[model samples]
Structure formats: C-alpha cells, structure tokens
Target: MASNIHYQRADYESGLDENSPLITGLTGRKPELKSRDGTASAMATFGLGFSIMWAQALIRWFASPTEFQPAPILGPDVIEPWRLVSLRIFEALSVGVLLAHIWYCVLVPAFPYLRNFKATDEPHQFTLDGRHVLGGLVALCADGFLNCHQYIFMWNANSINRGVWAKFLPFHNHLSSSRYGESLLWGPPMYVYFCAGFGILGCNMAKPLRKRFPDLSNAGIFTIIWCIEFVMDFVIENLAIRITHGYGYAKTYRPLTLFPEQVHQFPIYESVFVASLGLVFTAMRLKAYDTGRSPVEAGFEIWHPSLQGTVRTFAVIGFSAGAVLIFYHLPLNWLGVIGDCYADMPSYMKPGPVE
Candidate 1:
C-alpha cells in the first residue's frame, strides 16, 4: 500500500514531507471552486465603502468642519458679494461628489490587497479596472470646479471693489491674478489627457498581472500618484496661502474659498485624513506592481493609471506657484520695457474706474 502510494502520488509528493495530511479511509472528489465574478467584486467594494465611511465619519465628528469662504484681494469690485454664495454652493457640491465617487469606485477595488479586506480564495470574473480610470474623471471634475470658481472670484474681485486689495493684505491680489490663466490653460486639457493616456496603459498592464506579478492585483499605479498629489496639495496650498495672506489671516479666515480655513485652524485632523488616504493609494499601487516583474510589465502596470489620475493635479498647483514666484520678478524688460506695469499701465490695465 505504501509502495502504491509512493508510485501513484509521485507528482504530489516531490515536495511533500511528514507534515503532509494523512490519507482518509474513505475518499470523495473535492468540489470545484466557483469562478470569480461581478458579485464577488461588488461585495468587496461594499466592505471597502463601509470602512471608509466610518473612518471619514469619525474624523469629521472630532473636528468641526468649516464652510467655504472667498476673500478676493482685488476686493469687492472684482468679486461681487452676490456671487459668493452661489460659488460656494457650487464648490461644495462639486467637491463632495468628486470625493465620494473616488472613494466608492476607485479605492474599493484595492480592498482585497489590504490584509483587513482580504476574502477567501473565491474566484472573481470582473476586472474592476474601470474604477481606476473613473478616478481620473473625478480628479478632472475637481480641477474644473476649482478653476471656474477661481476665475469667477478673480474677475469679480478685480472689477468690483476699489480698495479691496489694500484691505486684505499686500500679495493676496497678485496671487489671485496669477492663478487665473494658468488654471484655464491647464484645467480642461488635463481631463482628456488623463483619461486617454491611462486608459491605454491600464489595458496593456492587466495581461501579465495574473502570472508574473499577481500582487499587482489591486488598484495599480494611478491611485498612488493621486495619493501623492493629495499630500502635495495640502502642504503647498497652506504655505502659499500664508505667504499671500499674512499669518494673522490664517486665524480668522472662514470658508469663502473652496478651501475652508476654519478646518485648518484646529487640531489638524483634516490634514491627517488627507495624508492617510494618499498613503493607502500608494500602498495599493505598489501591490499592483507585484514585486517588479519587468520594466515593460511594471510600466504597463503602474504608469498610465497613476499618471492620468495624479500628474495634472500636481502640475496645476505647481504652475500656480511658479506663476506667482516668477512673474513677480520681471516688470518690463523689452524694447519699450519700462517700470511697474501694474502702476504705470492705462486705466484698463490697472483695473478699477478712471481716476
């Protein structure tokens, strides 16, 4: 009997040891595993959603959330008071929807890679890759909302009030103006660039994941890039805000702008939450890379989704910062170059009514 077992079980015993299972007196065929399918994917998604919801709820509960407040340094002339309320409504709705969608669609797929969200070895049919691309759309929507709001705010602030600049602080008005055209040029184009570029990358990357790098099993690289962008935005924005508005302004500020200063004023809970999400995204991305299978495999795996989702985000903010720092230095240095254009230009260029 033992000889028969050795002969017949040669394939299974090549790597076996004493610890192997004992043979049963009676035997029966093991059942086949059901294939992976959409239902399994949806269940995984639901669990992820629940965890995120609870986490966000807990964070919000501890910190008193702030409303949006817009303070255009150009003053009332450029940013009309009447428009402020409407803009705030739009900003809030846009941000809420964008955030919710990202968490629901993109982040959920990554749950399986996380130890906490792991399921049994059930087979799954759904690709769930669409969620990754969907993330880019959410990000683009966020960019658009911010751009339109900023443009409207700048136009009104510059046109409406005469003394608004003097009332706010020194550099606030200047920063606002710099952000306008940059947002316009970069904002809309980003939507298309992200969706198209990453869409292609994701499709190609999925092929090798099953065999070469199964760990590259989750959300892939796009998610990670956006996570990085989230961190960069928080740090950079606050610093820029401080530089433009005096340190004093950071204290009393409410939410007219899409960002709520009140939220920033307290225990830093908001910052932590944002940072945590970024880290989670990054972790998922690495999992998608699956231990660096190959350059092309990694490229196909991580590059596009991360790029489409995050590159534009950082670029837009970076462009805004660059505009402020560089433009401030060069006044006029041409054939007819002269002194300060803001002070010397005609009434139209100067802004405000004729003196």
Candidate 2:
C-alpha cells in the first residue's frame, strides 16, 4: 500500500528512526520531538504532581484546623505601637529594594558588564546571559509560592499562631480563600532579594574555601552554601520575629526549639528546612549561568525559536516550584502538623481571631 507520509532529514538527526512504531503511529501530524535525556522532564512532572497533592492536603487541613490551640487566657497584644511603625518602615524599604532590582535587570542588557554584579557570579563565572535573569525571576516566583505554605502551616496552625501584618497591607486579614494572600504579596520579592545577596556571599566565600581545600567536591561546596543559608535564615527569621512581632512558632515543640524557655522561641528545624529552599534556588541559578540553559530547558530546542524563550521561562518556573515543594514545603509542614498545642502562650504571641 502506497502511503502519503513524509519524513525529514531532521527526524534522523533528532535520533528518531523513521520506521519506528512511535513515529509511524503519528500518521498525519508532525511528530513533536523531546530531548533524549528525560531526567529533567520526568522530575518536573513528578514534582508538579506531588505539589498539587501537597496543596490539596494543605487545603483540607486548613478547612478543619487542628493540632494547635489559642491561649485560653489572652494577655496583651505582643505587637506594640512602635513595632507597627517599624513594620511599616521595613515594608517601605522592601519596596525600594525591589525597585532597585528591577532597575538592575532593566540595565543589564545595555551595560553588559553589570552581569558580573549578579549574585551568582563566581570568580570563574560564565558570560552572563538572559537565562541568569530568567533563573532569578523564576526563583523569585517559586520562593513566593514556597513561602505561602507558612500561612497554612505556621500562621494558621493555631488561633494564637496567626501572622500580624501592618493594616496598610491589603491582604492582612484576607484568609477566606487560600490563606496565602499576605505571603504571596510579600514573600517573593523579600526572599529573592535576600537570596541573591546570599548567593553572592556563598560564591565569594567559596573562593577562600576552595583554595584552602583544593580537593573539595561540588557537593562539599553546596554543603557550605547550605550552612551559609541556614545561618542567614536563622538570624533574619529571629530578628523579624522579635522586631515586628509579625508571627511566632507558638505551637512548636519546646524541647526541639532554640530557646525552649522563651515565650517567642524559634524552632531549630525551621532554619534547616528553609535553608534548603535557598540552596536549591541558588544551585539552579548557578547551573543555568554555567550551562547557559536551565536543567528543565533541556528539551526546549524542539520548539520554534520565538516560542523557545517563553517555553523555557515556564519550564524554569515549574522546575523551581517543584523543587520548592519537595525541599521546603514538605519538611516544614510535616513538623508543623506534629507541633504541640501550647496553652501558656503570651497574649501578644496569641493571635485570637482571623480578623
């Protein structure tokens, strides 16, 4: 039987045999090809599926709301008038920092040298490309998604563990839908900016460490990066908690916390889990810059040149978001689920109602 099917030379180049059943099965349409290396695609698909299931589980948990309880006898509000004022000031500074980052991104093309200023620049850095900026943006959005889990697992765990933001913020008490409103607004910009700086610190610090111990592996270097992230996260989280009285680990198990006797103690595990988020993001950005393409961008060449940019962007976002789900959200939420219900919390630490 004579057939009308036609195959191009490119099909062979793409490693697809014209006589293969997979190719033959697609009779009329152009057979879209994917990368022969399927690791990134597989991981991304798995991560996305896991993330959806995790989100569904969290939604169910929020509907019932158990594990932690509000202090029976409320004291005074922990957030003082001065702390509110300070929080407003901090938010304003955050706005300025975000603006500066935007401006930097805008200028990077015109001033090509500015790429060296990006946080992921190692001494032996690759030439900065659009992928670096794209990686940062993806990390920013992914980190925001990662941070929103706190609203469900930390803030809303107990009536007393609620987050208290300045009233000026639009999403302050907006918890009717997903409890992520406030975190979605604040988390991405804040965490991305700080993580960039932390990446710079890690890169610079690595030079000395590498020279000191010439035989250090990439895993060893990342372990150091993880430690740096953990320490920085610890300091920043404690300061934010104490200064703004923004939120508390009211239901954290006392024996596992840093300051077990203190009313506003931090859980040691929080920093450990959160730091992994930064570590994954930093590794991704560094890899993107080094390889001139993200791990998830592997199969992107199959797309048209015009669409490749957009496709790669989404791929980076999906991969980073998946990494966040696996590394950050799972561990932190697991700990939150098993937290103790503390009844002796101070009034300030106990946020009474959702409003």
Candidate 3:
C-alpha cells in the first residue's frame, strides 16, 4: 500500500487538481492553472491543499483548550503530552512551506540573473526529489536557531502565545503567578501558521491543465480562500474557548499572550505573505505541471503532495517570532506607517505580581 501510494500516486493530476469551472467566472477564461518557470514537479497542485491542512492539524489537535474567562500560569503552557513535540512538528512542516515560498518567489524570478542555472529541464526539474526534503530541513535548522534570540530579552519584543522561540529556550517562570504564559498553544503564532500554510498551498498547488482547477491567476480565488480560513480558525478558537469553559481562553495577559494586541498581526502577516507569494508565483512563472526534466539533484522520490515525500515541517516558528519582532519595530520606528503592534512591559499586566 505504501509503495503504491508513494510511487504510483505521484501522477499528473488533471491540470494538477483543477476540476470543472465555467468561463463565466472572474477571469473570463477557461478553467486552467497557468504554467510557469519554477513549478514544483512532485506536488499535485490539488494535493498540496490537503498538505497545508495537514500542517495545521498538528497545531490544532495538540493545542491546549482555551478558557472563556481570563487565565494565567507560570512556566510554559503546554497542552499536556503534546508539548514540544507538536511545536517541533509544526516547525518542520512550516519550514517546508517556507522553502517552497522562497523558491517560487525568489529563485525562479531571479534565475535569469544567475549564470549557473537555467529554467528546470526534463524529469529532474519537474519531479520531486531529495532537494525538496533538504530545503525544508535546512530551513528548520536555520530558522529554529535564530529564534534563540528571544530567550535573552523576552520582554523587549512582540511575541506569540506559545511561540517557537520561547518553547525552544524553556521559558523561565520568575513570579509563577505573574509571568502568566502557556508554552504550547496560543493565538497569534497559530494564526500565522494557518496563513503560511494556506498561502503555500495556494501558491504551489495549482494545476497547469485547463479545467482541472480554477485559474491560479485569479486573485478572487485566493481572497475568498483566505477569508474562509480566517473565519474557520476564529470559529474553532471560539469553540475551544467554549469546550474548556473559561480555563482554555486567554483574556488578559500575564506571560501567556492573548488577543486584541496579538490579533492585529493576524491580518497583517497573512495579507503580506499571500500578496508576496502571489506576486512571486506569477512573476516567476511557476508551473503547476511538471517540467519532466533532470537536474543535478532530484527532488525526494516520495509521493507527498508537498515538495518532498516526507511531511517534515520546521520553518514557521522562526519566521513568526521574527516577523512580530521586526514588524513591531519597522512601523513604529522608521516607517511610522503603522501603529502599535506589541504589548508593553510585563509590569503592565495586572491581576498578578509585576517586576
């Protein structure tokens, strides 16, 4: 079963996953995924959507229940057994998406400038191989490591509920009551995860064949998709709040970051990420179909919808932390374009001991 699923499953789906679509739709063109330069060979554009959902499943399932009423805790808030395992898993999955994003957005578009490489040719260029897996893993290491910076000065930057960096460093609980925090699950970071996950899917999961899926070029599809995901996440979050009663929810802050402040980034990060990737996907001419070429190193010879056959993820954590940190500063200081995105010092949080 595994072999058949892995080998035979790696087939070219009808236009990479697009099904029936009417010309009456937005683009006023036939239902077809556009072909471009750096399209992923291994990914079944339609299958990629499932993979994005797969990444979120880990984070959502292991997530600690949120309480409707305000709550606080010392140390980190891990959802019991899930703990570091879920966080790390989420990281690896996100990393793969990140790598794919970079490739589509940066590499393919810039290929002309580079003397060494040309548009992918033959089976190696279009099909999946080890490079796909390595890219995600390598991103995991690089991204996983930089987040260490948050540990020393946790107070200075904007942060997520159970942000990857905080968990990696093992948050110190000074005033167990006051440091209020959960080490495993929270809103901001999780929201970012979905945004990235879906964004990645939308970017690379389109089929090149006409009528297999809707046209990837249509901005309306992505907009509707993004809106749907946000609503779904919000509803589920509320459900978690209801299910666990008040204990699962985050109202005020101790160390466990909550919404309003953290919530703003939800749209900001998602909008930017999706917009950037969309531009990259089109500009780079990423193909939804395989080039059916050969390159120096082939993609992982697995049948996963993602870049590689394995479901490794590890990139989003570093990006989430860094994104909050950087954006928090970028707007306030230099650009002065945006307003406040971060919370004040721990001393500001009430109901518990302050510094």
TM-score for every candidate vs. truth?
0.26, 0.61, 0.30
Q: Write the per-residue lDDT of candidate 2 for residues 215-263, one digit (tens) a residue.
A: 9998998898889889988887788666765555655655567765454
Quantify all predictions' global Cα lDDT against the true fold: 0.31, 0.52, 0.32
Clashes of 2: 2
The residue ranges of model 2 lying beyond 4 angstroms of the native Cα positions read 1-35, 38-78, 105-107, 110-186, 194-197, 261-263, 341-355
Error of 1 at 290 (Å): 3.1
lDDT of 3 by residue, 172-264 (tens): 233332232322223223333343444344444433322355554455544544455545555644443333221121122223223434311
lDDT assessment of candidate 1: 0.31
Query: How displaced is residue 284 in candidate 2, in Å?
Result: 2.0
Q: Which has the greatest TM-score?
A: 2
Sorted on lDDT, best first, the list reads 2, 3, 1
Q: Summarize candidate 1's per-residue lDDT along 53-126 as a digit string, tens digits.
A: 43453344235222112222333223234444443443354355445444443455444343246664533311
Model 1: residue 210 alpha-carbon error in angstroms: 24
